[model samples]
Every structure is written in structure tokens, then in C-alpha cells.
Target: MILLGYGFIQKIGSRDFFFKVIIYFALFSAVNHVYLVVNWAIDNPININRLRLYAGKGDVIELFGFIFIFCRKKLQINFRRKSYVKIAFVLLTISFLLYFSRTQAVAAIVIISSIYGYTKLNKKAIIVISSFVVLAGGFFWYLNKMEIPRSAEGLEGFLYKIKNAPKEMFSTDINVNNRAELWDKWRSYEAKLAIEQVLNDRSSTLVFGKGIGALVDLKDDFMLNGKLERKIPTIHNGYAFVFFKSGILGLSLYFFVVIILYLKAYSLKSANAISIATNNLLSGFGLYLMFTTLVVAGLYNTNSTVPLILGFILGVEHLNNLSVNEDSDNRN
Candidate 1:
């Protein structure tokens, strides 16, 4: 971690937003580590429920850091001095309310906070900040409203069989429970094995995957005594989903697309605090959702696509800002 920190610091002199993200992740991870050990010591065994809670908690922390950046930029609210910064207290209250849950509550609070920050700032800055809050709220609302796909539902049912089976299991898309229900305890480990198996055995699968209807073939009930039967090809992991449907080539394509989007977000660091915070927020939110939803929900569900869409938004913003800066330099 220290070595990673050094590498990140090395980028402090230039466009090194990627490295900065690494720093934030590392720092938060360190803090997480301390609490991890503490919680385990207190309870004798770490709580799975707490681990689940950790995802949203970590997101709240990142959001707070972004608020700090916005405060510093638009509000000029500094809290590190001798006298307490008045606006810092107000923003802190609003942030606490915003981050209490991972919902649309943040939008209203963020807008209010931005307006407070924008009071002495320019119209453009205010518009940008307000726009971000609206976009973020709209995106998350979409994710929340989206129904779990039938494929994902099938994967959930598939996972149920794996949990109950005695060395022999067959199912399809049966893993998703009613919100953290079922044998989620051992589920992720099984998904990890599935991903490993697919990665290790890519050569024999014709490098194209089991094909589009591969999962469909596995959903039959193999009953014996007029009661019930089984299924097959029920891998619940997302990358595994791509591998099963399209092979290593397909998984590679999907993986590359996500990485490229993240790289685009990182590219904006040289612009300003808003750019950096926006990029890091997207990265943090993506990774946070990736780890949480991939283990529990399927990848196709895509907990949020706001980040990729936002990355494109930032790319446009960057080009326009660059053109403006160039014209200003020419004028000077």
C-alpha cells in the first residue's frame, strides 16, 4: 500500500488522476482494514451483514470527500484553520443527510449545498454543480426502478440449487434472493471458482463461449420420483455470464469497454477539482457497485450505467473547456 501511495504521489506534479484514485482507494482501504480487525475482534467472527453494509458506507465516505472538494472550490469553505468555517458545518449537516442512504435524498441536499456554495461563485459554476446533482439523481433513480431481468432471475434460481445440492447441481439464473437472502455466505466463493474454471478452460470452449442459448439448455427439471429434478450451466457471476454466452472473447470485449470508460474518467484530472471529483466518484461508485452487485446480482443488471454515460459527458466537457482555454490563451 505504501509503495502504491508513493507511485500515486509521483503523479502529483502532472495529470495523474488515476494515481490519485489509487491513493483514495488505498487510504479508505487502510481505514477499512483497521475497522475490519476491530469488528472481528469485538464479535469473534466478522458479521456478513456488516460486510454488506460496508459497501454503502464506503460510498458515503467517498461522497463526503467529494463534498469537501466542492466546498474548497466553489464555496471557499476551509475547515482546517483556527476559527471554524461556518459553511463547513452547514455542508457537513447536509452531507450527513444526503449520505444516510444510497438514494435520491442526495440530489435535493446536493442541490441545496451547491446553491449555498454558488452564492458567491459564478453562474457557470453554479449551473455545472446543479447539473451534476440532477444527472446523478436521475441515473440512480433509473437503476432503482429497473426490474431484475429474467436472465438474472434465472441465475438466482440456479444459485439456489448449488447451495442445496450434494455434489451434483443443475440450474439456470437462480441465485438472486429477495435482497441478501439464501446461501450468499458461500455463493461468492462458488462464483469465484466458476470464473476461474471459465478462465482456465477457455481454449476448449471454441474461444467463442457456450453460445447464446447455452443457459437455456440447462434449465430443465430432471425429476426422478414424480416430485422434482434439476438444471445445468447455472453460473451466477457476470464475467462468467459473458464467458458462458460469448466465451473469453466476449468477456474480453466487455472488460475492455469498462476499463476504457474508467480511463476516460481518469483523463479529466488535469482540468479542475470538479473534474477530478466527478471522475473519482464515478470510478469509486463503479468499483463499489462492481464488487457488491457482481457477487450478489448478475453483471448484466449493471447496478448503474451512469458512470459510463457520465464519462462520455466529461469527454465532451473536456473538449469544450480545452477549446475555450485555447482561445483565451490566444487572446492573451
Candidate 2:
């Protein structure tokens, strides 16, 4: 991880190189999912669930970060061409909401609002406030009027099958509405059991943890029956996973990395749009990781895209520091 961070920092002086890479990668992923959806439509019309460009709901949000950055950086900023941003936002928002996943939809709303607020701070704030009230009111009214469906018999078994299955297991998209239901089970049982075992353990086990992948020892009946039956169950919560596997020292190190990156981003002096956008993306992603670690895996082992993007953002901050140091030396 240290080596990788160093490598990314080395590339910070290059403007828009990493940002363009990220945007192009997301575009490729989006296109790939479109093809997947088409294939699924032909093969299994009845079970056309939302298409994921990548695994996990959090990944969907990351994709939105790419899209948000792309639209902002790629589109022309003039009034005549500003329509492009609006058009892109509308189309991307609608398509992702309907076919991608709810998480992406929510991310789209957030990033769009944020970027817009950056451009038209005072006006955007008022508009966003009014829009929020209107949307909230309408949503509540719809919920009040809608009829609730009763759970059918044997549904639990079906859910169990999906929940324990390797690909579908713990996937929020597979059973979006039942997330709380699944989380309750993980929290009340599996996690609880693991915590108790730790508390009862002797030695300095709490300082070093049971070692990586040790949490898989908490498997139960649901996991046993699944095709992706595990030798060790994944702790859905990243923070807990780190603490359980690596102990307090590990968790502290993890936070130390985040705090250092945040400080770099906060202190960066770049005025370029791409640099500014990278900072915004980092800030958004940092918050996303904080919340997501409670429900899904963190950037550690899940995927490379997140760490890669974050690395480049940090690299930009490094570039800023370099410029600052150079200016001071020249003055001296």
C-alpha cells in the first residue's frame, strides 16, 4: 500500500491524466453494463434486475463520481453549451435510476447538486432547499397512499438461498428493500458472536487481531447452504472487519491514512478545474467510505478503482505541495 501510494504521488504533476483515465474507465464500464443488460434481456426477460457496472452499491456511487467529474470537466461551460451538462445530468440520472441501482441514483442527485452549488452557490442553495421540500412532501404522500405487500410463505427460504449464495450474498441490489432485514441478522447474530469471542479472548490478540480473513470462522446455516459456502464469512462492516482482523492498531493506522489524505486535499493550492474536481471527488468518496464501511467492504480489498482514483487525487495534492515548496525556495 505504501509503495502504491508513492507511485501515485509521483504522477501528481500530470494534469487531467488520471482524471481522464478514470472517466474513460467508467464510460467503458457503463458501456459494458449496457451490453450485459442487452444479453440478460435476451436470455432471461422475466428476471431483469438492475444492471451493475461493478459489484456492490458503493461501487455504483464511485461510478457516479466518475460520471459527475466527466460531465463537469468534459462539457463546455458557456451558456449556449451549458445545456450539455443539464442534458447529460438528466439522461444519466434517469437511466441509472431506472436500470442501474438506487445508490447510483442517489449519488447522481448528490454530485449534481454539489457541482451546481459550486457554480451557482447562492441560487443553487435556495433551489435545492425548495426542491428538497417538494420532493420529500411528494415522496411521503406517495408512501402514505401506496398499499403495503404482505410477505409470502417460503419467501424466507428463497431469500436465504440468495443471501448465502456467493455472488448474491450480502449484495444490496439483490434485495434492496430487505437490507435492514439482512443487516439486522448480521448485526444481531454473526457480528455479535465475533465481538463476544474477541472480548473473551486472552493474550494480546486484541492488539494484533486474529490475522486477515479470520472473521470467516463465523459461518452459519445460511452460509452453509449457499453455493458460495464459505470457510469464513465476510464481515460486511469494513471498520469492524479491520478491527476484528487487525485489532485497534490496524484501525488506527487506517484512520491515520484517511486523515493524512484529507489534510493534503484540504491544504492543496491548485486552482485548476480538474484539481478542484479531484478534491471534491476525494471529499465525497471519503464520506462515502465512512458510511459504506458500516454496511459494505472498504477500499482495502474490494476493488482497485477506488484506491487508484484516491491515489491520483493525493498525487495532485503532492503536486500542489511541490509547487509551494518550489515557490518558497525561489523566493528565498
Candidate 3:
């Protein structure tokens, strides 16, 4: 979609003040996080999908960085004119804030990468990148620490799928890809089964679900004494979790809104302010869609991050479309 919408991203990104798009999105997405975390900490239960957006600790802080960028733009600053090294230093400081928050390694990487791009010198960029080399190694080590033997089993299951190639392509038995293929299948299946249980057991009138940490229901009992059944929760899938919480009708409404928003943002092509601003959002969404099965996204309940990021991109694209359209009208 990003490629399809390249014209749009470039158009908005082209503007002197286009960086505001990033600023607005970062702040908005962060504030959204506050909403989610509060609900989870207080409410017995909440929709995992909804929480996925802003509940993340990093989600909040990262937005602050964007706010910083926005402030700079408002002041009419230029990287080429200012102290690029100092700018990189500030961003690096912000990254530590994220590292301590829910381990947002990827977001930090992207942010630092962005900082490098905005910097003035190749030599300085190389220095920044090299300094992070240690960081890259540390992140991998962290992943190793987080990935236990059981998680390794997840990896093996993925590998088996690749080697055996499920009787059907995405059906099952996806190997080595670990969470990508199998986790996706697992989450998707789990969500469906759990929902079926809900429908059969409960009436149409939706009420609060099994309650806090109900994710670990063992054959319908919280105490593990009942039976050694699998204790899974949150459906491990974004849309599914929402449906489980809000019901099918809720999901239908959401789908309608999302589809409308996506279409409106996607229609522009290198055209104007709106399209330019929204273009990057569309690209990220496209990238996520291509490689991400339900699993990669739903993991850690990171649903909101995708949409928040996508939404920002869309907003920028929309703004760019307007810019271009006006430019054309002015010429006309």
C-alpha cells in the first residue's frame, strides 16, 4: 500500500512543515495509551485489542519525542542549521525512556534511524549508527533472555511448518517462523473457539466477561485444580478480542469506520496535502498486512500501535492531498 501510495507520502513529506504530521501522531497515540492503561489497572477487565493501542509504556513516551519534534518545527528550526549531534543526543536520551518501558526495541530503532536521517553529516550519522551497534547486540541478548525453552519450542513449531509445509499453505505446521505462522494460527483458532464457548454458554445480552486475568480459565475454572487445560486469554488476535468484548455488532461498526477511513486516505495519489500526509500511514499498514499474520500483531496485545501509526500516516496523507489540491486550484 505504501508503494501504491508513494506519491501521497512524498507529497506531504515534501512540505517544509510536514514534520508536524509525525508530531501530531506521536502525541495522539501516546495520549491514547494513557486511556488504555488506566482502564486495565482499574477495571476488572477490558478489551485486550483496545488496550493493545496505548497500554504500552513505550507508547506514551515515544509520543513525547514526537511532541518535541513538533515543538522544534513550530519554532522554525532546521537540522541543517542546528546542532545535529545535540539533536541525536536528545533522541538517544528519549530512547532510554522507552527501553525501560515494556521493551520497545523496534520503535527505538526506528526513532534513532529517523534521527539519523534528519541529521546533516554522513560521518555523524555513521558515528550514531555505530554507537547503537552495541545497542543492537544488547537488544538481541534481551530477546534471547525473554525467549525461553518453551518459546524456543514455538520457534521449532514454526520451523516444522516450513519444512513440512502444512497440507494447506497457512492452515498449520508453519515452521521456524515461530510466532509468525503458528502463533497467528494459534491466536486465530483460540479466539474463535473461545467465542463459540461464549455464544453457547451465554445469552445474546453481553455482560462483562470472566473478569480479571480470566485469560487463564482452566476448563472454565480459575483454579488449576479443575483440570490441566490450556489457560489462554485475549484471543491473541486484535479484531477477535474486540468482538469478544463488544460482540459481533460492535466489530461490524468498527469495520465500517476503518474501511471508510482507509478508503478516504488511500484515494489520493501524490495529489495534495492530505494525500501526502496520509501516504506513509498507508505504507506502514501495507507493510504490516503483508508479513504480519494475526499473531505478530496481536502479540503482547499490540493492536493499537499499528492503527495509531497507520492513522497518523493517513492524517498526513489527507493533509497533503489538500495541499496539492489547493496548489492546483491556485494555478487554475
Candidate 4:
């Protein structure tokens, strides 16, 4: 997908066009999400779990669209685009909050806050802040409308997930008697097993990994049914997935690529609003990818749009560099 995005951008020869494409797709996704929510609400008015079914992996990319539009509005003085920004912000925010994904919600708040910090505070800033307050109040009101009986329902469920995040990522203790705790710690358990297998294998395996198609053995077969299958093909941790398949070398190479792209995007200096917004979007996405890898498989997750977006950003940067070089030569 990365290569495809890069090639496509090269063919199009306009970063602005690509940005618009992303935004348009995001809007389409938001509308579909709203439809899903409304349709589900009409059918299952009392079921919170049914509402959660509408959340999809595409929500993250849609979020990137929101960030792109928001930053563009903040950096540029375009009164005509204000309405579009407000509409996109409201729709995307509703879709995002409906997803109930803690990682994504955290990423959005942190990235948006960071962007807000660097930009000047004005009427636009006040509008954004006020919008957030209104949306947050609405979110809580929606939660109140739901009949949440368990810890894993509505706002309570979201808080429970946040509370268990550390244990999910690092805890070694697994309580078989408590199904909730077991499910919460599943990622950590699988990751630990993968790491143990790598270390126990031949030293050579540590360098090149078990080499794709490798499986990690869960000694107890806790996740298995009556079939006695203890080995699994994949784990949730992106780092472990890479290390398990290709060893430390592959993992290092992956980080190297991510770091290079992030730095390139961050280093891009532009007075143009679109270029500046693109630079911020790319760099913010790099940070989001780095954080999400610990739990959501990050770039390795097939559901994620990270690779495609990263590729597009890389292509834009490549073109930007070429334009810079051409100008330098012409000046000389």
C-alpha cells in the first residue's frame, strides 16, 4: 500500500489533490458512520454493544482527515473554509467518540492538543475549545441514555479499558477464573510467550527471527478449544510480531524507516497552508503509529491505513525535495 500510494502521488504530481482526496473519503466515511449509528439506534435503542458494532478500523484514517482539516483552518486565514471545518469537526468527533477506542481517542486528544499549543489562540481557537466542551457534554448525555449494567458498557467500559491498559500491555499475571481479566491481559500474555520462544530458540534465530510463518506456543493452550491447538500465528504487539517473524534486524529496519520519514516530514518548512498542514499531519501520524504499535499492531495491522498514508506522505516529501533542489540549481 505504501508503494502504491507513493506511485499514485508521483503520477498525480499534486500533494494538494491527494490531501483533498483523503478529506473527501473521510467525509464519505463519516456520513456512512453516522448512517450506521442512526440505523443501529433505531433498531436497538437499548443496546450499547450494538452501537459499538459500528466502529471500524477506518475510523483512525478518518481522524487523520479531521486533523488535516483542523490544522489547515488554524494555519490559514480562510473564512470560506470555516463552515466546512466546523462540519467536519463535528461529524468526525461524533464518529470518533462512538467508536469507544481508548487508544485512538488518546491519540486524537494528544495530537490535536499539541497542534493547538503551537498555533496562536484566537476566535478559531475559542471555537474549537467550545465545540469540544459541547461534544463532551453530549457524549456524557448519550452515555446516560444507555442502560449500562456491566463494567464493560458505555462510559464505564471505556474507563475500565483505560484502567486496564497498563496491565494489558505489561502484566504477567493471568486470572483464568476471571474472564474479564484474562481477556484484558491477553495481549501481554501472547507477547510474553512470543518473546520467550525467541530467546529459547537457537541464537541465530534472535538475529533473523523465526522467519515468517513462525508460530508462538502457548504452553497452557488457554485460548484453544477442544482441538488442543496451542500455537498461534500472530500476536497483537507490532514489535513482537516483527521480532517473531524477522528477528531484531527486521525490527530495527522498521524503526529506521519510521524515524527517517518522521524527521523528513517534521523538517519540511513551508509558508503554504496546505504544505504546513501536510507536514504536521505526517509527523503527527508518525507519533500516533509509534504509540499504537504497542497494542494495536500499528503498521502491521491489516486494518490500519498507516502504510498507505505514510507512503503518500513520503511521496509528497520526495517531490518537495525535488522542487527545492530545482530552485537551488536555477538560482545558481
Candidate 5:
């Protein structure tokens, strides 16, 4: 899909057109998400999981739209058109907030801050950082005052998830006897098991991995159906997932791709608004991918749009280079 998207962008040959298309698609998606959220609120206000079910994987594309518009530099736009873009941006943001995904929310903050710093917008950067601090403080206060539970529903459930996020990722006090405890720290637990399995193997699996379809033993079966399946084929931690299946070589290769993309994006000299936006988008996404790997499988997740976005940016860079070469030849 990534390569296909790359080839498609190159064939299009116009970055402006591609950008416009993405913007339109993003706007339409945002509207749909808002509608879903509204309807869900009216019909199943207590069931936040249902909202997630209805809006599966749409948040990823919506984040792309938000980042593009947020990082955009001065592109001449009429007042009415600019108003519409603003509305779309707001809709995207609202829908994203409703999703209650900590990883995506954190990625958005990091990406935006990185872009602001890269662009030398010190004032905006300071303001954004300050705002984040204030909001975080308020959130913590609410969590403490309300004492929200893990099984909570709706907005309270979202807050509880955020409150537990740090412990979820790193806590070592899980009770093996407690199924709920195991499920709560599921990502960390699975990663620990994967590491143990890799170390237990004394073969070349250390370097080359256990190969595809390798399952990590969870010691006990935790399937919802009460089946005797004690092994799970996938882990939420993407780095661990790759290491378990492909070994160290595969993990290194994944990092290599991210590093290369970051370098390529950083090397770009932004000569115009489009160049600037693309550079920031690519650079920020590379960083976002690195952060998300620890929590959400990052590039390995089939539902993610990270690879597609990466390929699209690379395609844009390729077209820009081609155009530059043509102009230089004409000058000669």
C-alpha cells in the first residue's frame, strides 16, 4: 500500500493537486466523524467502545488532516475558503478528542511542538507548551477528585484511561491471578513474555527472529471464549512484535527506515509553503512513529496510515527534485 501510494503520487505530478485532494478527503472524513459522534451521543452515550467501533481507523487519517492544516505556512487563501478550512480543522480536532486515544493525542502534541520549534515559532511553541501543561494539570485534578474507575463509561472512562496510561505502560505490579490485572497491563505483559521467549531460544533466532506467525506464550489462556489458547500471535508493542517475529535484524531494519525518512525530511530546504508543510509533516511523522511503536504497534499495524503518509511525502520530494532538474536544464 505504501509503495502503491508513492507511485500514485508520482504519477499525479502535482503536489498542489494532491494536497487539495487530501484536504477535501480530510474535511469529508471530519464531517462523517462528527456525525457519528453526535449520533452515538444521542443513542449510546454510556458506551464509549461503541463510538470507537463506529469510527475505527478514521482517527489516523483525521490526524493527518489536522497536522497538514496546523503546520501550513502562508498560502494565499480568500477569506471564505480560509473560514471553511478553519471549520474543518476544528471538526477534526473535536472528533480526535472524542476518540480518547492517548497515543494519538500525545503524538499530535509532539508533532505540533516539533513543527513549531523547527519553524522557529518560539512564541507559538511556548504558548502551546504552556497550554498543554495547564490542560494536563486540570485533567489530573479531575481524575483525583472524581476517582474514576477502569470500567467507567463515556467521558469519565476516557479520563480514567488517561489517568492509568502511565501505569499501563510501565507498572510491574500486575497480579497474575487477576485476569483484569493482566488485561490492564496487557501490552507490557506480552512484551515481557516475548523477551523471555527470545532469550530462552539458544539458536540463531536471536539475530533472525522466530519468523512470521510466531506466538508468544502468556503462561495461561486469557481468551474471552475460555478456550485453552495460551499464546497470542500479536503484541501491542510494535518493537516487541517485530523482534518476536523477525528478530533483531527486522527491528533494526524498521528503525533504519524511520531514521532515513527523518534525515531526508530534515535535509529538505523549504522554499515555499508546500515545501515547508511537507517537510514538517514528514519529520513530525517520523518522530511520531518512533513514539507510537512502544504503545500501539506503530508501522506494523495494518490499520495505520503512517506508511502511506511516509510514502506520499517521499513521492512529493521526488517530484520536487524532478521539477528542479527540468528548470535547471531549461536555464542551461
Candidate 6:
């Protein structure tokens, strides 16, 4: 479906195709998160715990980051430059608060700040560093000070858990006290454990993998509680899924493609303002997806959003090349 969607979008051949998809995704994701936030705020009929929005958390955050870049780079709705930046900044901040997605938020922040810093480096780096410092300070303050409704008490209850996430990462405990665990136990820690389990006896599997359904077979061995008879059909971590399914060779190829794309996107040089901005945003999106894949299980998941993202990047890159070549020909 993702591939088909990508093909269809590319077939459309509209320069604004990527922009339209990203903007729509961003808007829908933002609205969904806002709805959850309001429910969390009001303790309403639909609470945060019970609410599960259709969009993946990874997609939501990536969309938010993509939209932020769009706002800064492509938006020309009669808004001043400052107004565009402010709008993007506000949307990002709101999404972080309401969605409570740490990995995505971290990725978005790092990418945005890096782009800002890179763009300002020749002029002055202090402005970029200071901007980041202020944003971080304000965000932490909000996280600590935000009042939680009684119905959504888990939000406040996890403050200490979040604070201890780094230290608790190595711990073996998967119980309540260990709630601060990164990737929610299954994706991060258990995924590592599963890898160890697979490689313990059959080290050769590292080369060729156990063959396609191998991860599914090993799930019960590593994840079963003895209380449950069912197995998790999918591995939570995308890298782990690939490694278990196709071994180290597959994983290497995957990263190889990603590295090529990142290099290609960043290496694009353009004096045209729109071209530069689009290139920067595309590069940032690439960065954001790199982190998202760790926890997203997107490699083999049928519902992966990464393909669509790659499609847009490739499309935009193609368009950029055409424009650059046209300029060169005209100059000649």
C-alpha cells in the first residue's frame, strides 16, 4: 500500500504533490493530537488512555517536523518570515505537549535546530545556540509544571520515570517501577534480548538470518510469559525485525540506502531560496526518519510510512535536479 501510494503520488507529477500530502498529514495529525490533549486536559468522556488515534506516533511526529520545514521553506500565504517561523514553532511545541512522544520530539528538535544552526553558522552560531537553549528551558519547564487532570494521572505519575529513563535503560526489571523504560520495554530492551536469543545458538543466522518467519518463531521464546499462548506477529523495533528476518546483510543494505539518500539530499547545492529550503527540509526529514525507524517497526511492517516519505524526497530531488540543470543550460 505504501509503495502503491508512493507510485500514485509520483505519477501525479505535480510539483506541489509532496507539499500537499505533507501539509494534509500535518494538519490531520495536529488535530488528532489536539483532540487527545483536550481530552487529557478536561478529563472527558474520551480519556487519553483509551484514545488511540489512527495515525502512527512516528508518522505524526515526522509529519510535524516536515510541516515545520514546509512552514519555514514553502509557505507564502502572505505571512512575514517571522510569522512563518513562529507558526511552525508553535505547532511543533503543541504536538510535543499533546502527543507525549519523546523519540519523535527529540528527532524533530535536533533536526530543526541543526538546520537553523547550519543556516546561521556563517553569520553567528550564538543565536542558534541561544535559541535552542531557550526552547529547551521552556519545554522542560512546561513538562514539569503542566497540571495533570485526575483522570489522566498517569501523565504526572511518569515524570520521575521519564527523568530516570537513561539510568533505568540497562535494568532487567520490566515491572511497574521500571515504567521509565525507553521504547516501552518491548521495542528497546526486549528487542535487544530477542537479538541475543536468536544469535546465542545460531551465530550463522547473523549472516543469512533464520529465514523470513524466524522472528515470529522466536517471539514466544523471548516474549512469552507462560501465561499467554500467543506470539507477537511483529517485532517492535524496525532494525531488529530486519536483522531477525534477513540478518546483518539485510540490515547493512538498509542503512546503506539511508546513508546514500542523506548524502544526496544534503549534497544538493542551490542559490535559489526555495531550492535551498526544500533541500534542508528534505535532509531534516531524512534525519527524523532515521531515529523513528528504531522504534517504529517500519522495515517490514505493511503500514510503514517511510516509503511514502522516501518517495516525496526522491520526487523533490528529481525536480530540484531538473531546475538546476535548466539554470545551467540557460547560463550557457
TM-score of 2: 0.64
Error of 3 at 20 (Å): 5.5
State the lDDT of candidate 6 residue by residue for 1-332, as single tens digits.
Answer: 44664566567765565655565566567666766566555754443334333222445434544555445444222334666546655674566555555665576665665444353334465676677779877866666576543334345534543443333333455553443343245455556655775587477888877677653543343324344533455665677777777788988887886566445435744456556655665566556656656656544556756566656656665666677789989999
Candidate 5 lDDT over residue span 86-117, tens digit each: 77778877877777678877888777766555
Where does model 4 exceed 4 Å of error? Answer: 45-50, 54-58, 74-82, 113-152, 220-229, 265-277, 329-332
What is candidate 3's lDDT per residue for 38-122, written digit by digit as tens?
Answer: 6664964443323343354355335434433533543233556356525543553444343233224434443334322322235
Q: What is the Cα-based lDDT of residue 103 in candidate 5? A: 80
Q: Score each candidate by Cα lDDT.
A: 0.43, 0.51, 0.44, 0.71, 0.73, 0.57
Best by lDDT: 5
User: Using alpha carbons, what is the TM-score of model 5?
Assistant: 0.83
lDDT of 6: 0.57
Rank by lDDT, highest first: 5, 4, 6, 2, 3, 1
**Predicted structure 4: lDDT:** 0.71
- Give the TM-score (vs. native) of candidate 6: 0.70
lDDT at position 289, candidate 5: 83
Candidate 2 steric clashes: 2
Task: Give the better candidate number (3 or 5) by lDDT.
Answer: 5
The residue pairs found clashing in candidate 5 are: 209-247
Q: For candidate 4, give the lDDT of residue 36.
A: 84
Best by TM-score: 5
Q: Which stretches of candidate 1 lie over 4 Å from their true place?
A: 1-182, 189-206, 216-236, 264-269, 289-293, 296-299, 302-332
lDDT tens string, model 2, 246-285?
7788889887765554333354455555445555545555
Q: How far is each candidate from the true structure, as Cα RMSD in Å?
A: 17.9, 7.4, 13.0, 6.2, 3.7, 5.9
Q: Write model 4 residue lDDT over 85-189, tens digit each, in one string.
A: 688778877776777677777677746664544222457757776887798678656665666444566566665555567788999878757877777798998
